[model samples]
Target: MSSDRLALITTDPAVLSGQAVIAGTRVPVSVVLDCLAAGMSPEEIVAEYLTLTSEGVQAAAVRGAAGP
Candidate 1:
């Protein structure tokens, strides 16, 4: 419900070489976007990646960052 998309994901040098990922998980933002781009639904993505949530996928699509 917030406009600040950055809050949905994080980037840390210790984590995936600072690649953007979901706030509390290692799932990369790019992965989520890739799923969507591949014609996968948010629900499907969430099912495939248990660490992901519908909200996170939405944020990833919007700000190129996965959900918390």
Candidate 2:
């Protein structure tokens, strides 16, 4: 699916210290983007970061790509 979907997943100040991490983890959205950029497949991402889902990774890609 399109990555823009992740826009709905955010870190509000009251959440995640406003660091723009995933909804429930300390892992920043950029970390997910970096892993994809470094050639890590969605399955590998899920394997490496147990907390991440393939769909979440894809959504993060969409969100990261949406930035200015």
**Poorest 10 consecutive residues by lDDT, candidate 1:** 59-68
Tens digit per residue, CA lDDT, model 2, 1-68: 46445754677786567767766666778888899899988899889998877767877887877783
Per lDDT, the best of the predicted structures is: 1
Q: TM-scores, in order shown?
A: 0.85, 0.76
- Lowest-lDDT window of 10 residues in candidate 2? 1-10
Residue-level error in angstroms, candidate 2, position 45: 0.8
Candidate 2 whole-model C-alpha lDDT, 0 to 1:
0.75
Candidate 1 is scored at a TM of 0.85
**Pairs that clash in candidate 1:** 56-67, 60-65
Error of 1 at 39 (Å): 0.2
